[model samples]
Structure formats: structure tokens, C-alpha cells
Target: MSFTDFFAIDWSGQAVERPKGLAVAHARAGTEAPEIVDRAWSRQDVLEWLEQLARDGTRALIGLDLSPAFPFHDEGTYFPGWEASPVDGPALWQLVDELSADDPHLSATSFINHPHARRHFRQRGDCGDLFPPGRGRFRVCEHGQEAMRLSPYSCFNLVGASQVGKSSLTGMRVLHRLRSKLGLWPFDPMPETGPVLVEIYTALPARLAGMRKGISKIRDRETLDTLLAAFGSAPHRPLPRYDDHATDAMLSAAWLRVAAAQSELWSPTLLTPELACTEGWTFGVP
Candidate 1:
């Protein structure tokens, strides 16, 4: 139940080789401040890094800031009314991967641009007919996050800052590529050895650390270290810049170290077996 390292990824879905929003950070099993990885990373780079972590026999809990699967329980189908929707999270990941296999840099353009699948997403100036009425659907874990006053965006929403739709799809491709190389939580049971990756909403850590909904983003060394201390982590050395991507990665990685000790987080009252397989839960949402 203990991990040698805790890492958080501020992920992106941009089609470019190196996404500007991509960042990664890690905190070892100690009080030392979490460190922002001082390297540029592309989606492919992250995939290779994680594979190396697994191959090195590292015991790590890597939290990915993207939905593992789309809302299944609320609508009972990822693409409601479609006769050929995936049956579970793993299947959905597989579909996204296979469809986007030719997309460069792990991009999911092919899947999102697929004629059958495109109708279910919300794109700029072209809200698909099948797109939901409101802010789109929510998985059980996202609903739990909303219940806590933290805004949750649908993985099917591809427009606006609230849209994580494309990000989730691209992340699913990475997950599919990662299958068997490492364990994906809920979809694949927590492994006793190697690396275990879990879906994480970085805002969860900020909310728990006393930041409000409107301004949960950590922006300054003062603010970041303050929240880091709240997580029982030591003060972090000041970075030359405090971009939201790096700060969120560092704070969430720091928080994961603390969140791992609480047994209740490993089990949630609402996460039933079926939902766990179809709509994976966010790691810190107990």
C-alpha cells in the first residue's frame, strides 16, 4: 500500500509533438519538496518515460490529470443511441487507440475526427447533434467532485477551457498503448508491483488544501509552497517561473504522497464494481 514515488502529470491533447501545457513532477516517499521535471516532454515522451519506470521495477503511483473514461452510468452509453458503442473503459481506450494509431505524437485526431464519433463531441462552431444538452455528461467520480463544489468538465466537451474531451481521448490512446506495461487503476486492479496509474483531478488537491473554486490554480512560489506545506511537504525551492502547469503538477504530486496514507480514499461508498470497470474513479475523490 506504499509507493516509492508519487508523480502527477499536467497533460495535454494538442496535436503538436510537444504540447505547451504538458508538465510532470514527482515527490519521493519523504518530506522533501516535490520537484518539477526539468525537461520538455511530448505525449510520446511521457509514454516512454512511464514504460521505463515500469521496466526499472519502480513502485510508483502516477496520477494523470485526465478522465480515464467517459460517463457511462449517467447515460448508460458513451455515445448514447449509437448501436456500436464500447462496453467498458478498457474497450473505449482500445477503440480510441486503434482509431488513432496513425496519429503522430500520440495525437487522437483520427478518433475524434471519426465520422461516427465526431457527432458525440462539442467542437468550436460545430456542436455535434448528439452532444448533450447541458455541460455534457459526468462520470461517477466527476459527480463526486462537483458535489464538493469543484467544477467538473465532461470528457465529451471539446470547446472552451471546461472541455477535456480531446484531452481525454488522447490520454486514452496513451493508456491503450500502456496496457500490460503498467496497471491502470480501477480498469486494471491496483498492482502489487511495478507502476499503477490513476486518474486524478489536480483541483482536488488544491480544494483540500484550502483554495477556492474560482482560484484553485497555484500561481506563485508563496502560494505553491503554502499549499505544499498544507500537504505536510517541505517548502519547495522557488522556480524561475510559476506557470500553472508546473505548479499544479508539483502540488498534486506533493498531495499524492499524503493522500496515499488514507485508507478511505482507496474505497469510496459510491464506486460499485460495475462503475469501476466502465467509468474509472478519480484517485483523490473519496
Candidate 2:
């Protein structure tokens, strides 16, 4: 079944009162351009927006710029040497939800602050030494990403700008709440109707749009316009130099508008059952 709309979200994991980098964009069927749905959405704002869309029976394919699960298959589990590591993506998400049950508005501070799990992330200076040499950093999907020439950072690394740990951890809280309301790709089979959420890496679409490697962010209107035109989208108005969040969301939505129709994106030749069940595949990964 084809989706009636496409949506892409640029998520932020900052512990701010209101997230500034979060952006949302959408493209409806038959539209030549994708529009910015929300340029400054908070975590709670996005949750309510998605809930409303689900209630409205929107048949949309939602792409979130965050890892849905951590490195599991390579190490056999997320937490090495711990006997109680989650067995799969759903189990891991459930564990995060349970641990962060008391967090307000789906924030994952509780889980990130937990004594047992906090050591896995690199946010705290003392936690970096907890991980042994190089045993538990990447997942099978990440290895595939490397094969495709994309630099995939470990979700456990929360230090550098490329690190996705905080966002993925916070996204897990939202995913746990939305699991019953929306279909999560790879973990949950696509439903006949309603919204379906998939993990997306914006760099894939940016590269397809002719952006150079190591230059992931778009800072100029000309470059953004060229990227949009590659997807057959209409010309967009001028945007600021630092609006990478908006550019990522808009271009990703435009890319998904075309890519979602292809069966290869949904079922790649390399997608194994183990990878699909434990470490979820990025929707547009080759």
C-alpha cells in the first residue's frame, strides 16, 4: 500500500526547556513541494502533533533522524557483560520506557542518569573508560553504513556533534509511547492504514541530492534550492545559513516522497531477519 503523505523530522536531544533544532516537514501526494510543518517543535509538541495525525487517519510515512536501536547483534546484546541486556529492539525500547517511566513529557533523563545504563553513554567524563577497547560500539546496520561510505557514529557516543546517543535515547521514550499508536518499521509490520515510522539518515538523501561527503549540512539557499530541485520540488524561499535542521527535514521529506514508492527501500537485499529484529535498518540505506 502506498502512503498518502510523507513526513520527515529532524530531532534534537538537548536537555533544553524547549528544543530549538527540532524541525518537521511534510509533503502530501500530488504536491510538487514539501513544506515545513514545524520549524521549532519541542519533544512534547511533536508527540501531540503525531498523535493528532494518527487520530486523523493520516496514511503517512514518517522518517525520524535518530537511531531506533543500539548495537546489539555484534556484541550479542547492548550491554556487554550484563546478563540482563535486552534481547531485541522492542525489548530495548521497552526497557528504556520502564526505566524512564517517571520522566515528564517523554524525556529520557532518568534512563540516561540510571547508574547501570549511564556508563554506556559518553555524556559523563567518567563513563568513557567504562567501555573496553572496541567491543561494543557498532551494530550490523552501522557496519553496512560504513560499506556504503557513510560514517556511522555509535549511538553510545554522546560527545561529538556527530554522536547520536542522546537523540536515540530520547527518541526511544517517544517511540515507546507511540508504538501502540503507529507502526514502527522492521520491528512492527506495516499496517494497512495509519502512519508508519521509520529510522532515516538525512545524509543518504543529501548525498543523493549531490551534496559532497563530509559536507552534510546545507547552509545556503542556492544549495538548498538545488537539492529540492533534484527531488522535483518547487523553489523554496530564502532560509538562514544555520537552518540545517529545516533543510534536512524538508529535503528528507522530498526524498521520501519518491523513495517510499520503491520496494527496494522497504526491503533491501541485505536486510537480514536478525538485523531487522534487533538493529533496525535505516529506511533509505542501500
Candidate 3:
């Protein structure tokens, strides 16, 4: 089932007083007027709603004003840096794909695919299946608990100079698409665990339209930092508080780790035939 439609809702914690003041939007059909359930929903309430949708088999892209996955694990979970993280790209993406596959109409998307978010995942070695295998398509998962697959896909690790607005713009564009195509109004709930295809973009002084390089180019530290610092100064940046800090630290850490790893792999010796043949192999001795 394709999650082509959209829905949204305002989930601001306590600042909004009554649930009646809460706002929700579905693409077109839902109540013309806002629907309020007694009071504001807690995180558990939202999760339960999504669980029901998945059980019922809904196929739609459900947008939330909340951060589905956080960089830091709940309040006090220990996140040993990348060195101890067993998570690989395929493993993480597969989880997200499976978690939402059950809801034929219950799909999800977020505006948090910036370099910061990517870096944080790398630092903690804990990106929970953001990218799935097979040309941006996600697998369907009916079982709630299944082992994750480790398959590589065309994943985007958008790093570079700081404050470039990569996260905010990418997220906003996603929200815009969800609102436009899925008839998603704000303050709505999702009910499925199907696929959610995310689109990403970069921010820079020079135009980056039509540029298709490997993941290495986009995820460079200097470039990400330059962009991030610039975007932070922008008038409309909207990344969450916790995410903002986590992403920044992660991006910085990723660059350092890659640079160190690269240095360790370097060699001063030339690529001679002797070097070409590894030890313990009988080559050209016939």
C-alpha cells in the first residue's frame, strides 16, 4: 500500500492549556471543524493512536509535529560514542521501515534529515533505520518484533559546514509535501507502520542544484559546519532544542572520527606488484 496522503497535528506539551485549543489537519476529509478530545494527549496517547492505525492497516503518510526518534535515548540512557555502536545504515533504516509498514494508511515523515541529525546518529552509531534498501522503498512489517536487516541502499549522510539550514529546509519541504498531497491538516494521528520516503537537500553559498556526487562529498565536516552556522543565524530556523545540540555535537564528532580512520589507512609506499600480492598466496608460481 502507498502512503500518499497526509495528516498533521500540534502536540505542544503544556503551553497550550486545553486539548480544545489543539489543532489537527488531514488532507481534505476529516471534520471540517477541529475535533478536540477532552484534553491534550501524552506521548503514550500518541503512540497508542499510531499502534491502532498500524493494527487496522492504514496506508497514508502521517505527519507529526513531534520528533519521532530522538538522538539521545530517553532521559538517562548511556550512549557510548560510535566505537561501541553496533548499528549500521541498513539496520537502522530497516527498523523504521518495519515499524511503520503495518499501517497501510498510516505513514510518517519528519523535517529532521539535516546533517546534524545524521551526524548524531553516526556519533552514537544509533541511526534507527532512517534509510531503507531498494531505491528508497521500505519493506512492510506486520510483526512488531523482528530482527533488523543489514542491507545497504542509496543513503544520504549530509554533513558539511555548520548552520546551513539543511535540517530545517528538508523538514519544512517534507511537511509542505505532506500537507499538500495527503490533505494533511494539523493535529492529526497516524495508524500504520509502512514506508515513508524522505527527501533531503543541502544549504550553501553556491547553488547545489543537479549535483550528484557520492555520500563522501555531502557529508564533509567543514561544509556542514559552514552551512549550519549560517542557517542558525537565519530568521526561520525550526529545529528542536534537544536535536539542535545533539546534531551539532554529532557532526563535529563524525568528522574527527573519519579523519582519524583515513589517516590510519594511509601508506607512504607506492603501489608496486610486491604490495599488490598479499602474504600467504601463491601467485605467478605456476
Candidate 4:
């Protein structure tokens, strides 16, 4: 008998072919050589591959750049909010409280209650339908849908002292690791903590302008800054103004319309962004 395996990792914002993909071939016994490489991918690219790759009794080793042990800062510690925990901590509970205060959606209680809250957590929740009665998948419900949808958002306010490098370093390190996993460059493991000095490169104004066409409205500084940075440069500007009610209404309406339409029948966003925000379900995964 011979065996084969597949390995893949997400690079940048999408998945790229990994060198390990070509490594496995039908073999009786012998260590297969590892192949590593990095390639860019769009959302559609990955979806097509997944559709083709899903098959009976086949498994692919997959990796993502996102933190795996998020919300698990210390084995004995706990946080009430924020899925992404600091590599180090000022006690997990206190950290979570701070995150909860900043971002109301993040909560330790939610992590415990939600099914897909852990990044690396794995289990076969629907395996009962995949067996022959009690032995193999001979009689199973075909209409039973597996896997539940999840919220794709989390936000926080920058507090008294700016932890400017904190987010930047963490995000960049994840990006770099993705690149490395795809064999795009030499592997660089970021020290779990420290002042990792780095720079971010992106067209701010252009990016914000693009989001505006799809956005219904803005709530916090982060979303506003992201939009303003992309819309136009306010030179020597400390922060963007967001108190104009008329502008909010316009943006809110535009954002809600698109988000609702995109959700189709799976999930529905109300007709206005303001209503959507107040409802705490601004977007839906259909």
C-alpha cells in the first residue's frame, strides 16, 4: 500500500501553494522531501482549490497566519474579553477586562460559549453522520448542514499611552510567518514580546475611498481613520472629525444597503447602518 498527504498555508491575505504540497507521493516507506514556496492568492483561488480538494477520508495539513492560542495568554489565567491575548500579560482577567471595555464585543464568556472561538482548536462535531449507522456513513442525514457562521470583527480603542508598535508588530510578524511558511523568504520567528520597530506600507487615502463605496457608516476612531487615510490626506491633522450627523446618516445608509444586499437570505442587516450597529449584528455570513 502507498500513502500520500497534502500541506498548505495561507500567505498574505490568502492561501498560496506550499512546497510540502509536492513532497508527498505514493510510497511504501521513506521520508518524503519537503517542498516550500510562496505564491499569491485571491479569495476565489482558495475556494476553487477547496472545492476540488474536499474528498472522503482525505485530510490536508493547513496553517493560518492568525494567532492559534488567542485568548489563552496564560494556562492558569483568564480574560473576560478580546480573543487575541498578549504573548505576555498583566494577569489574563485584567487584560480581558481592558479589551472588553475598549471593544464591547470581545468577552471571555463568549469564548467559552462559542463553538469556533479557538484558532487552532479542532474537533469532529458532525462525525456521527459520517459512519455506517454506528460503523460507517451508510445512513446519514444529507440535509443537515454542518459548521456554523461566525462574526468576522473585533475592534479596540487606543488608550492613554499609544501602544503603536504593539498591533503593528503582531500583525507584521504574522504576515512574515505566512510568507516564510510558503517558502517566500527565510523563516523569521518574532520574539514573543518586545519593541519590534517596523513600518507599514499602504496607500491610506485610496484604501479608505474604496471602503467608502461599500461602507454604510463609521463608528469608532479606527474605522474613521482607516477611511480618512484612504479618502484623502488631511496634512498636519491630528485626527479626523466624526461628529457630523448628516455625514453619518449618509454613510450609514450606504453601508447598510450594500451589507444587507450582500447577505442575501442567510443573514439580514437592517436598512440603516445606525440600526445595524445598535443591533450588534452589522454584517452577516451567508
Best by lDDT: 1
Q: After superposition, how far is residue 47 of candidate 1 from its true place, in Å?
A: 0.4
Ranking by TM-score: 1, 2, 3, 4
| 10 residues in a row with least lDDT, candidate 3 | 277-286
Best by TM-score: 1
Give the number of colliding residue pairs in candidate 1: 0
Clashes of each: 0, 0, 57, 18
Off by over 4 Å in 3: 1-5, 11-24, 27-38, 66-81, 86-286
Q: What are the runs in model 1 whose C-alpha is more than 4 Å off?
A: none
lDDT of 3: 0.27
Rank order (by lDDT, best first): 1, 2, 3, 4
Winner on lDDT between 2 and 3 is 2
lDDT of 4: 0.25
TM-score of each: 0.97, 0.93, 0.25, 0.21
The global C-alpha lDDT for each of the candidates, from Candidate 1 onward, is 0.88, 0.82, 0.27, 0.25
Q: Write the per-residue lDDT of candidate 3 for residues 1-286, one digit (tens) a residue.
A: 2243333343332212232212333332221221122235443354455555445555534433322222222112112333432242222223333433442222322213223334332212444353323232111110100122122221132223222222222223323323312322111222234322211111111112222233223334344444333322211122222222222222222222222223321221222222221111001010
Tens-digit lDDT track for model 2 on 1-286?
A: 5889999999888877477778898888764778787445788888888998899999999999999999877677788766667998878888998998887656788887777787677775655555556533887767777787888888887777878888898888788778778878888888898899999988889988988888988877888889989988887755544488888998999999989888887887778888888888898876
Task: Show pairs that collide, candidate 2.
Answer: none
Ten consecutive residues with minimal summed lDDT in candidate 2? 127-136
